[model samples]
Target: MQAQQFEKLSLLVDDQLDKPQSVQLLKSVRHDPALQAKLQRYALISQALKGEQAAVADLDFADKVKQQLKSEPVYLMQRKKSDDQFKKTSLAVAASLLLAVVGFYAGKMHNQVQTLAQATTTAAAEQSPAEQMNAQFKEYLQAHDNVWYVNNNAGVKSYARLASYQSR
Candidate 1:
């Protein structure tokens, strides 16, 4: 048979031919024994391909997968109780150590400030009024000299620091 005749037979087997085209192909097929044999061959090939798909689907693939999953060991993911307890204990100990260090520094500073205040009071009592005023003025001048660097700096923050110490 010619290639065009084989192609028309394939299109007919696939249901791709329109009604008029199918009628024309059928008319040609009626007169040709070779075309009838070709149609039977195409139908056999199509049925074989479809049968393979149906055969595979009928083999119970889903049921086999379920059986495999049921045979596997179940696993649990979680930390042990002892590890959680240890983490909480370590965190508490670290917080207590931090508080203790902070308390020690605060108490030490408080004691030093009290001692300095007592020393200043005792020194002021020993000096006469005129000597005390002169001593106070000298201390004030020394304090001002300590922050003299602020006078040359330029910024709102620098002026703020200077203003806080200006009167005292």
Candidate 2:
């Protein structure tokens, strides 16, 4: 058969063709013995491809498995559906409760941090300029308190020079 006819036969086997296309192909296949044989071959190929993937491993594969099962002890464990359902429900409830608790604590912590920040800002706003300058100077001194103890010998000299310049 020609490639186009073979392709049409494959499409018919797969039911990929539209109603009109399928109807026309079916009519042509019904009239021609060659088309009929080609259609059957295509169908067999498609069935084999699908079946091989789904169930069939090789010749006598199922028979071998059946023989093996017959020789082995059979396991017949009964499942308790109630136990499984309860476990699933309990796990879901516990997870939701945990999430709620975490969310509540996070919101509480965030509020506490915001309130503390706001109080500090308010206090800073109340401070006079001189007071603010003194606070800044104290913070600077605390930050650089360890600078004079640096490994380099120039650290003390550098700090003294800076202090002198500031005083001047």
Candidate 3:
């Protein structure tokens, strides 16, 4: 195959051909062994540039390399740039999602701490056992008038039993 035809075949394999060029190259190179060989070498070079492993062949090595250097496309360079930008965008979105989850948990913990502080402040004002006992004794004393003057032992015993029952 002519070097120029081989270059066009490379463009077709790389999907850089438009409709007219692609149809022309496809019909011309479909049964041409030399053009197929050039396309295979071009594919190998593309794979090597992309950090993929491919088997290298031994035919017309220097000529194929020179042709590849002359025929490299503008779009391949742009494809690499777009791929890098996409990766960066994906990483940024993942970082934002992680930060949102952490912020939500931090806000929940802060609200829980505030609720516990309010409960602690409320727990300080409840009535004590001694204050409750004093109030009950005062009420009992006000309701009875004859207990202070009673001197009979049997009456005192009966009155003590009545007082115990009334306290309950």
Candidate 4:
């Protein structure tokens, strides 16, 4: 699935299989001439590339590898210290960016809350009961501006007139 995985599989194919297992695999496919030809072609290619086929013919590869290991040992040293340092730096940078985003949103939310509080206080100050009643009365008077009051000798009476009254 990954280049690393493919490389590991290739290493297994080239280096890990026992000679008997390799022979068994080759023999299993020997009936298929095309498969045998392909194996021979790859063997030749490997021989040509490595210049070690003659040595392979004389020696058991797995035993030779084990003998070489007994003679000259190998150890893997840890080298991820610098890589780990870089990872920590990357994590710190990401954390700073995340904090900046949160701070920006918090600042924006704080400003919005302040503005809302100011607006509510302003609205409350402007909405006294007396002021509301006066506004309603003024609206009613303006809507009925064409009406008139008449006082007759018999009784107080009301009349309608087309004259309009305006208020500021």
Error of 1 at 80 (Å): 3.6
Measured over all alpha carbons after superposition, the RMSD of each candidate to the real structure, in angstroms, is 17.8, 12.4, 20.3, 15.9
Which of 3 and 4 is ahead in lDDT? 3
lDDT per residue (tens digit) for residues 83-150 in model 2: 88999999999999999999999999999999999999999999999999977876776688744433
Worst 10 residues of 2 by lDDT: 146-155
What would the TM-score be for candidate 3 when compared with the true structure? 0.30
CA lDDT of every candidate: 0.79, 0.79, 0.75, 0.64
Question: Backbone collision count in every prediction?
Answer: 0, 0, 0, 0
Which residue pairs collide in model 2, if any?
none
Q: What is the descending TM-score order?
A: 2, 1, 4, 3
> Candidate 1: worst 10 consecutive residues by lDDT?
52-61
Top model by TM-score, which number?
A: 2
Off by over 4 Å in 3: 55-168
How do the residues 75-133 of candidate 4 rate in per-residue lDDT, one tens digit apiece? 78876568888999999999999999999999999999999999988986789899878
User: Positional deviation of 26 in candidate 3, in angstroms?
Assistant: 1.9
Q: What is the lDDT of residue 112 in candidate 3?
A: 99
TM-score of 4: 0.33
